[model samples]
Target: MAILPICIYGQPVLHTLAEVVTEFDKELHRLIADMHETTVAAPGVGLAAPQIGIGKRIFVWNYADQDEAPAIGVAINPELWIIPPEPGQADPEHEAEGCLSFPGERFELRRSAAAKLRAQDADGKWFEISATGWFARIMQHEYDHLNGYIYVDRLTGYAHNEAMRIKRKRNWGKPGLSWTPGIDSLEG
Candidate 1:
């Protein structure tokens, strides 16, 4: 397992709809392990295939509530269902989130409070999970990546403007930009 370089906002893979994972072979398992290693190294809650320049419907996530041990797993060909978020502007302080693709930037975006996800594991076995709070947020965030979206694309109000400003300042939103975790100063 190794820490893979994360694609930045401009990468084409990060903007394209990821393809489904069909072959559960050694290659698939190795990719999942590398993704898991990279997520832990980045110290992020999750990482998606597209973020690592792999256009497959796969992601790895690690989460732990204070009351429980860490839950870590790979989701292959995921299908997510989220409870619609309340209608209103997102709370800037409490709702802020960052993406590995965007790295080091956080912007507020309203998201569902609860979510139900159905996906297969690394071995192609199916399972389901219900998540809330930050776990749900992680699910939604990674899911968006598989669908060719960056979290910044969902920003609204002043946050949306701020995101655009940052995008322009960084000269992002094009292609071929990326950063290696541990080596790069940027973190998400």
Candidate 2:
């Protein structure tokens, strides 16, 4: 396993739809292993294939901060169904999150309280899960990555404006940018 460089926001691959995983072989396994390593190094709860500049529908999550977290594993070509979020002002303390792509930035965005996920493993085995609380939040975040969206892209109101200001100030949201976890001072 190796730590892969994480692509930043505005990388073409992050904006482009990822291809479905058809052949579950050595390459897929290696990529998943690499992603796991990179996620751990980045110290992120999850990492998606596009974050590493790989345009494949795959992501790995390691969520251990909460009770009954999902097992750390790879989710490929996953489909997500969410319970609608209640309408209200976002609670930054409770709802704020970050992204590896938008390194060093955090924003408050409302998310579904619960979600149902159907996905496959690296070896092409199907699995289904119901995630709640922070695990569900992590799932929604990673799922958005597979669909060519960073967390900032989902922000609105003051949070959205703040994120955009930061993007402009940092000169991010452009192509040809990447960072290595455990090596770069940047954090997300």
Candidate 3:
């Protein structure tokens, strides 16, 4: 497995909706392996196919809670459902959210506290998973990428403006912005 270069926010590939994965063959498995390696190298909680310039409906995520071991898996052609928080449940601290594509940025984006996801594994076996808290956040973030949406797109008002300002300053929303893990400085 090789660590692939992550596409920055400006890449057109990222904005395009990813195609569904129909062939569960060796090529798909290899892509999943590379995605896992790239995600780990990015040191990110999750990554989508589009983030790595692959327009296939796939993603890899690794998230751990204080009480559990890390949950790592690949999701192909995933279908997600956002579950509303319990009555009186507090909202998530949106400021803590970050994306690998938008590297050095964080925004106050709202998302459900829990989610239900149905997806196929690398071998084409299907499974369902329920996630909450940070895991749910990661799921939503990666799912957005499959639909050609970014976390920043969910921001509003002042927060949205601030995110755009940051992008413009770094020329990230334009085409051809490049990134090299461990070498590029993403100082925001």
Candidate 4:
């Protein structure tokens, strides 16, 4: 498997809605393998197909720090629903999230405390999974990518302003992008 070049914040693909994965074949398998390798190399908790310049609904997530963390592999054509917090419950945690597409950047954002996911495997097998805490947050972030949104899109108020400031400084908010894998960004 090869590490694909991550399409940065300026890439149009990251903003465009991804197409559904219809055909499961050798090419799809290779892409999934490459994505997993790239995720590990980037040392990221998750990644989506659009980040690699492919406008397809797929993502991989691995909470590698945990001893029993399960590999997310390729979640194709995934659908997600955020679980609402209980009544009288405190607000969900707001935490800083980093993206490989936006190297050296992190934005504090709030998301649901839990989520349920429905997706197909690389071989087109359907499955459902539930996540909470950090894993839930990561899945939400990656799901946004499938719907043509980056994590920055979720920022608000001061966080939004700060993110925009960084984007402007790094020249990362433009529309076109191209990069060589591993050579483009030290972290990516």
Specify the highest-TM-score model's number.
2
Q: Specify the highest-lDDT model's number.
A: 2
lDDT of 1 by residue, 1-188 (tens): 88999998889998899999999999998999999899988889899999999999998888766222238888899999987999988887889999888777888889998888899998899988888887888889999999999999888778889888887888888888888888988622
Weakest ten-residue segment in model 3 by summed lDDT: 86-95
Best to worst by lDDT, what's the order?
2, 1, 3, 4
The lDDT, on a scale of 0 to 1, for candidate 2 is 0.89
Clashing pairs in 2: 104-187
Give per-residue CA lDDT, model 4, range 1-188, as digits (tens): 99878887878899999999999999999988889888887778888999999999999987754322365555899999996645442343457788888777777676787888889998999988787878888889899999999988877777789888887877777766545456665442
**TM-score: the better of candidates 1 and 2:** 2
Determine which window of 10 residues in candidate 1 has minimal summed lDDT.
62-71
Error of 1 at 34 (Å): 0.7
Between prediction 1 and prediction 3, the one with superior TM-score is 1
* Global lDDT of each candidate: 0.88, 0.89, 0.82, 0.81
Order of models, best TM-score first: 2, 1, 3, 4
TM-score of 3: 0.90
Would you list the clashing residue pairs of candidate 3? none
Clashes of 2: 1
Model 2 worst lDDT window (10 residues): 64-73
Residue-level lDDT tens digits of model 3 in 1-188? 88888888989878999999999999888888888877777788888999988888998987766232237788899999996545432334543688889897777666788888899998889988887777888888999999999888877787789888988888788777757676677775
